[model samples]
Target: MQLEEPQLKPRDYVVVASMLFGLFFGAGNLIFPLHLGQIAGANWLPATLGFLVTAVVLPLLSVLAISATHAEGVYDIGRPLGKWFALTFMVLIHATIGPLFGTPRTATVAFTTGIAPMLPKQWSSAGLLVFSALFFLAAFLLSYKERKITSAIGKVLNPTFLLLLAVVFFVGFLHPFGAPSSAPVTAHYQQAGLLNGFLQGYNTMDALAGLAFGVTVVTAVRGLGLKRDRTVSAVTAKAGVLATAAIGLVYVLLILLGAMSTNYFTASAEGGTAFNQIITYYFGAAGHALLATMLTVTCLTTAVGLVAAFAQDFHKHFPKVSYTAWLAMMSFASFLTANFGLETIIQWSTPMLMFLYPLAMVLIGLSTTSAWFHRAPVVYGFVVAFTVVPALMDMVAAFPAVISKSAVGLAVTHLRDYLPFATVGLGWLVPALIGLALGLTVYAVQQRQHAGAQEME
Candidate 1:
């Protein structure tokens, strides 16, 4: 079947970039990284750079990968595995970004930043549950008309949030309370700060979300009446570059603010405490209250959008279910998770990212390489096999307690001794290379066979 192609427009780099940046720079994207910087102190710059590479660069590649390949969507990008593989990939994307991580995180962090301190100590969890439900219901209402609301939010609310954040960070930097110190909370944490910070950026998970957003963006552009293939790809690329640049700038600014916060704040404050303290130190109680309101609104809006998008996607997969039913299920899950508190949520989420990030990276790598290999399965097989091992090691290392309790943990410990570079979370690098070599060798032999057959014919 022949398909009508999508057309493009004279790219508006600023608008596209602004949209991309707005999409990526959710609440955690702004606050947590800064906290990481404050704690890392002198180590903040390196750690921040590493964080940006993963948080910023990987996400950009994800968008670029989709634009360059022109896959129908993320599923098409994983097509060598066939339909079910694509479905599973889709499910993972939804699960990762929905109730499992993203949705709950927005609620939890919002409460921490906006609601917790104001609540009587005992009423906090109950308050969070009630508040999150109301917040998500509002999200549902907004989601009913997502495009208009999202576009409006992008144009108005997003810029205001950014402005407020910029003011907070800039002011904090100008009058930092404590000097930047090399001393971190611990030696191991300090040594691993950059890597940890890099991985933490995964919580933004725009890379995974990009797999879906790319298709959405393409569709939006098409609706604008651009219907050519090259235009679609070009527009996608332009939009991606614009978005990533904004995200990178915000991350760098926040990290600097984090480092500078050390000049006023101390080690006892980390995570949310550092965040609140920095704002209060610079802006006084009124400033803190205003910023808190902005944060609550920002985080709540993000939560609603995430939940609505996920619920719509979920309903598509399970057509028997009503959107309302699914939204309720997701909202309930998010509500329960919010009670776990922000710090606990952050701790638990680490291993999942370690496990998922490498797989996501491989998908991005292969999708981008599809043209070079003519969409070969051989390359995919090798990369997946090689990368899975190291990613598993990294996941276990990040959560030793998880391994210590299960039979799987025992198996991993035994394997670690024989695995080269296993202690360093790089056990998979060698295996991946070997797999690539084997695949290339096989491809060469197959090509020769085809050449001989063609010559004979």
Candidate 2:
């Protein structure tokens, strides 16, 4: 005789949806779509739609996969693949989404959007060094203190940033820079706008965040009083839809804002520059500090959270290293990486994202369909194994031009060219499908074999 937990109402899911969106929206969410619009230009419609598929659709599915699998954190998300493979997957995910790329990206974005506009060209390098140094240092200090500042980032700074951004969106859209239809479409965009947009969604990094933020969202839902597993999964899926819907809308608006800017300004290095230019246009010289402060504070808060999460997760795994030590290393690495400038950082990040996304996508797909296959390890193993070769080739094919044209890269490129969809940076697709077919075949065979053995017993 147990009392049932009270069911949540629609209003309660709105709060959960907002929480999920807060986790999804960050520096990348702000800039990537703007850059996509600027480059895609007249083709922004298909591009935006494609971006929504990866950015919104995949992430929403990922959140649901988390509940479907009853997993905690990204580590558990990969556990079905086997201990060693799971550990490897977890390491790759956290590294990409943490110290190696995502954390440094936070500082670089803040610098490019906020600080660079206010500084002279010669001072740009020096400015980034100083800013990222102090930025990560402060982050390290705060993370050392049990992440209390997240409260500030959440309760205070996040809302403030959103409010300020909303004002920018309101005014910028109101005036209108130019029509997206009339904007000039770049050559690459003209050729492959949809695929380019899909790739561009990788910049949001939300797919990976979807995996990382899974447990957090689930815990939040549980805290909201949904205790049954089925109920929790339903609530999570509904909440995910609401959250991703909001994100998709924001992405569209950001793209529009960027497309409009083409009327007054030429393309910049990345979306950050465009963002700074747009703010300056609307608010004049005074907008400089306003935009800079806003981006830095928002990005800083994001940086602190990433570093804390990274340090905390790594510390739990390898207790030989102290939390403070892990925190210091990640902060320092991210600061050093930021000095390379935003353009280079983004360029470098693309290759890794190209490789990891397909693998993560496969995992999420498997997790969602776990019940059909009875969570078979052979199925998980075969799919990942088959997908690895093509994924690696796609990654190598996307290396920096210097490396990409080098002998090793060229060899990999030749191999990748043989794979379908290779041209659009998704050469892994056919291979992944083939892998799925093989895994299912093996899973079905195993099920029949076990059934026969049971009859004999």
Q: Look at candidate 2 and tell me the lDDT of residue 253.
A: 93
Q: Considering every candidate listed, which one attains the maximal TM-score?
A: 2
Model 2 Cα lDDT, one tens digit per residue, 79-176: 88777777788788878877778888888888878888778999988888999899998878766765344344445556677788889888987889
Model 1 lDDT-worst window of ten: 6-15
Deviating ranges (above 4 Å) for candidate 1: 1-13, 178-186, 189-196, 268-270, 315-332, 396-403, 406-408, 417-421
User: What are the lDDT figures for the candidates, one per model?
Assistant: 0.69, 0.80
Candidate RMSDs in Å, in order, are 3.3, 2.8
Evaluated with lDDT, which candidate comes out highest?
Answer: 2
Q: 207-317, model 1: which lDDT tens digit per residue?
A: 777775665566555545567777777777887887787778778777766776666556534456667766777777676676567676667556655665565556666
TM-scores vs. true structure, each candidate: 0.87, 0.90
Worst 10 residues of 2 by lDDT: 146-155
